[model samples]
Target: MSKELEKQGWVKRTTIDEPRLSEIVSEYKSLGYEVHLEPVHLEDVDAQCKKCYENQSDKIKTVYVRKRKQA
Candidate 1:
């Protein structure tokens, strides 16, 4: 019984959003398997992400989801 609570053996780990994680865990459990969730510390988030800088375009102005940018 105590062995069930032990954190040992293989696990699949990924940083997914909460909603998606819940969906995946629930889906797995529905198929009848124990799901173990553990937090992973992502300590090295890039402060100067060059990819982000490259992908971001100049901000576009819009209004009412179709109108125009406000002055």
Candidate 2:
């Protein structure tokens, strides 16, 4: 997580496979959270999964969510 995001109260949720990203994002929004997505970097991948990610065309992303402030 970046310092800026943390300062703004964003919390790391989970890394989701590309196919399910939209579904999870919608779920978070429906529950009143603001969603942020960042691409999963090679360094962040586990040793066993690194090869899989590199060989596949699909992407993985880290999800961040922050509660919406009351108006």
Candidate 3:
């Protein structure tokens, strides 16, 4: 999975020890998309984005922009 991302210049095949992150990468690869897992701190505002993405909710399905400042 990581190899495919590297091939597409989306991400480098470096050591990723996190199991969940690796799983996400593998899933995206299986779907034929080049993706790199972006590290997110749970305490930050982007954590909400991560949660929304995980839940697959329609509320967050529309175009949403993340603010630079953490709320």
Question: What lDDT score is found at residue 3 in candidate 2?
Answer: 88
Instruction: Report the C-alpha displacement of residue 1, candidate 2, in angstroms.
Output: 1.7
- Candidate closest to the true structure, highest TM-score: 2
Comparing candidate 2 with candidate 3, which one achieves the higher TM-score? 2
Number of the top-ranking candidate, with lDDT as the measure: 2
- State the lDDT of candidate 3 residue by residue for 1-61, as single tens digits: 3355345555433323345555655665665655544432333335645664544332221
Candidate 1 accuracy as lDDT: 0.40
Model 3 spans with C-alpha error above 4 angstroms: 1-17, 41-71
C-alpha lDDT of candidate 2 relative to the true structure: 0.84
Worst 10 residues of 2 by lDDT: 51-60
Lowest summed lDDT over 10 consecutive residues: which window, candidate 1?
59-68
TM-score between model 3 and native: 0.31
The best-first sequence of candidates by TM-score reads 2, 1, 3
Off by over 4 Å in 2: 56-58
Root-mean-square deviation (CA) per prediction: 18.9, 1.9, 14.9
**C-alpha positional error of residue 48 in candidate 1 after TM-score superposition, expressed in Å:** 9.7
lDDT for each residue of candidate 1 in 1-71, tens digit (9 for 90 to 100): 12343344324533344456677666766655556654332232244543343343222111111112246
lDDT of each: 0.40, 0.84, 0.41
